[model samples]
Target chain A: MKRTNEFAVGLAVLLALTVVVAGALWLSETDLNKQQVTAQARFRTVGGLGVGAPVTLRGVKVGRVEAIRLVANEWVETEFSLDRVVELPPKPAVISASASLFGEWSANIISYDPPPTDPNLREALAESDQVGGDAWPGATLPDIGQLTAQASRIAGDVGVVTQRISQAFDSTALKNMQQSVKDLAEISGRLVEFAGAQTTRIDRVSRNVATTSDAFAGVAQTFQGAVARLDTATSDNQLKDILNNGRASSADLRQAAGDLRSVMTAARENQASLIRVVQQADSLMTKIQRGNGTLGMLASDSTLYRETTATVIQFRELLTDIKANPKKYLKISVF
Target chain B: MSPPVASRIAARDGFVAHIGRRSLETARALADVRTWSPLLMGQMRRLGVDSVPIALFIAVFTGIVLSLLSSYIFTGAVPLYFVGALVGKTVMMELGPVLTGMALAGRVGASIAAELGTMKVTEQVDALETLAYDRNAYLVVPRVLAATLMFPVVTALAMGVGITSGWITAVNLLDLSTPEFFKGLKLFYQFKDIWFGLLKSASFGAAVALMGCLRGLDAKSGAQGVGQSTTRAVVLGCEAILVLDAFWALVLL
Candidate 1:
């Protein structure tokens, strides 16, 4: 073989070897020159994260995963290397998530001060922390497939809810709602009409009140004049004398009222007797009307009344005869 | 036994005998590394170093096409950076080794078979045998050893070129930046990916070179046989590559 050929072969082999080794190192982010800080995190799952998976801090590539192992049948502990320059937060936590729709995954180092917005992730972090290790807390974010499945389930639930709503708001419900609206409209119309009537009545009442107010004004004026006159009378000594007389008269009236009250008390006491007497009177009057007694015969018998009238007329005639022939009737005059 | 059964059994025996002979030849050739060691560099220069351009040619286009294709497939379904991932992974894991192997199989396998077959048909191999020369050592060992040693080197170069081509295409043709493409490229990268690919290519190299040598040794019918051996070597080499690729994946990955 020519020396050139051997040289070419050697060069190619050397270059190819370099490429393989260097490519692996570069892609793996195995920086031997720079210092790396090894840290660990425990997760319930790694979500397809494997060795050499990039470890990022706030979306910035900080390091790569070195190893992952299941510890104690409960959690997966991942040991990763971060650039020595990386300044970890006060409470650094790790979240493993599908880097893309593809099966790729990455671990993101974050602060645990503000917990993750996702409830499941927060709970996973809490659980990891509760495991009580020096390892940073870690949680697995759901992959695309899991999220898609959950979305499908949520869509199904929404579809069911929509179907139920459609069923509930059927034609019958629509008609009933329409009827209720119509009744409301009708009631509103009646209320409007009633309000109009009340408005008119109020206007009429206002006019009546205006007239009454005018009449009251006149009455007030007359009352004011009377008050003035009263004021004038109050200032006069004659008014005082009148007041004195009025007081005396009021006292007399009071005494009279007291006497009247005594009479009334006596009358109230004899009320039964008075009622009896009245009843006897009524009976007597009834007897008189029936001509059962002398007074009653006098009151009711025309024959007795005519007989008395005739006796009086005969006496009168006898007196006239005695005057003409006195001896005939005067014989018994002295007895 | 009936005549047909007897003939089938006879054919089976012949086949078994052929396999044994080929196995023996391969074993002897591999064992005679000392004899072939001086010739190894020349063969390496011819088979591995010479084949770099072609392997890289295949890999560049493969990477370019994969980038475009992955971009198309993963357009809205995933982030565009995943185009870098798909290109890197496909090239490193599958296309880089397989394509480089198959290309070298066509180039180097046919070359070996044609050269050796021509020599066999021209009685050069017999002449060597008559001179007490180990034909397997002279003919097979150096070629197989060179191929085995250098196929990985060629594949490694090809993988690098392939990924570089993909990165270029993504940055130029696709809406991707250097960091983004690299981020995706490194995202799913594993050291085992390179190891497995190199291992697979090494197996491919050995198979292709061995098949060519075995076919060349078994050549007949002169010029026609040489052509036939060349064709068969290329065909069988490709088939072996595929089968071995699958085997490695199943076993290693």
Candidate 2:
């Protein structure tokens, strides 16, 4: 090719590329197919909307931003093009989420399941087969920005709470709390004594939890198999639960993870009880070390001590009382 | 003969010289824009309007990929409304501007840099100066003004398209309701967002254009210098856009 021609060809290619991009953009925005079904969504507040922002469902490319209007003081109307085949769930959980942290705003239609529950599987027809515009909302939503922000806010509060808890643990003289700990120790000692006879009950509860864990593990194995099958289904996409397929397996795994986390949290909450149990065990060990009780003496001492100096002290106390008030103490009283 | 006085005097002289040169450049660019408003109309037709298809393809894929990525991790506290909103907000407020600016900078800005660099290496700039013509006004301003004007328009279009692509994914692949999807958009977005988005794009466009023009005008040495200027223009253009985008997002968005 001639030099000028080559340059011209390069420019032409670039130009063609741009034209194609623009045309494709226009088509996507307009939803050039079907042309009907005026897809509209109502917002409590349309923050900084113009007539030409894109409307999306679940972060996918669907249609263009046709227009936005203020219907009333409190309500705003946003109209856009939507491919007719894509069903909109009734009462779908809609939120302002972006595909990118810093990008255009799009509408995510969560769960998009239709009303009148329990559609037969073989009979589950497409919305195009019936009237469009409503379905069941998707699974539990993660509040993207709002959750992160609120989590951050909650984290700050938690930091304060955590510091206060640490301080409560650290607080000494001014707290009037050392006495409380002493009282707690006494109460705990009493509780150990009380539960001493109830070892059988604690054992039973532990056994029950074990049974439940085993049963849960069996169910979990089934879940893992189901997930493995799903992993195959998802294929190279490596879906990994991000897509939220609304399948039972996904729900099971999610719930199981949640349940497991909760169980761990509960265990953490009882950390003090666990520690006390360990401390009580150490005390029992110490008493045995000193040969102070039946177990301790049995472990160390061969003979039991009979009445000795301590017995004489009791006899002396009785005699001293007798001398202090003979009439009352001896009961002679001139009778 | 204290060193402090001499240093102060030199600093003042340098500042004055810098200001004088910059002002002269600015004046030349302004004059160029005035002289070649008509040519710009043609160049834009060839350059700006020409880049449509690839932009659309990119925009669509961007939406899809972003959607795939955005909901990568979900904490079940808040509902998924903001997942959609994240896509919207990022595309509208940040990525749309940044990507569009960078694309234009790489595609359009580098060309301006190379053209100006070549003119300088060959002393065409000096010839123009000798003819009592300001090179900035004749060569730099039209490209700057076109880019400053055209880029934001492209970005807005890209935003519009990106959201559309996101919708397709949401409806078909993600299986979200179209109505609820739009509802999230309606609820979250406002007019200020659009204004801020455009403002950022315009500023970014101007920065990239200016950087490209400056590098081209200031080119030294041979072919290596022209290549260096082009590369520097692209890098500086992108950097300036990003920094300015962040600043504008903070101040305006």
lDDT, each prediction? 0.90, 0.66
What are the per-model DockQ values? 0.56, 0.02
Candidate 1 residue A133 Cα shift, in angstroms, is 3.6
Q: Candidate 1 on A1-335: residue-level lDDT in tens?
A: 57988899989989998998888878887868869889999998898899988889989988889999999958899999999988999999999988776687889999999988889889999999988878999998889998899999999999999999999999999999999999999999999999987998899999999999999999999999999898898888768999899999999999999999999999998998999999999999999998888988788778987998999999999889989997775675555
lDDT of candidate 1 over B103-169, digit per residue (tens): 9999999999999999999999999999977998988888988999999999999999999999999
Tens digit of lDDT per residue, candidate 2, span A1-335? 23443454346445444643553443334344565465565555444333545545666755555666666544455666666766765545333344445334555554434432435211222221232343212111233566688999999999999998887676565466778788899999999898998999989999999999999999999999999988787885657455656576788999999999999999998998999999999999999999888889877865534454567787798788778866776554455
Model 2 residue runs over 4 Å out of place are A1-335, B1-20, B27-34, B75-77
Instruction: Provide the global lDDT of candidate 2 against the true structure.
Output: 0.66
Best by TM-score: 1
Candidate 1 RMSD computed on C-alpha atoms after optimal superposition onto the true structure: 22.2
What's the lDDT for residue B88 in model 1? Answer: 85
Range of the 10 consecutive residues with the lowest summed lDDT in candidate 1 chain A: A326-335
Segments in model 1 whose C-alpha atoms lie over 4 Å from true places: A99-104, A113-122, A154-335, B1-17
Clashes in candidate 2: how many?
86
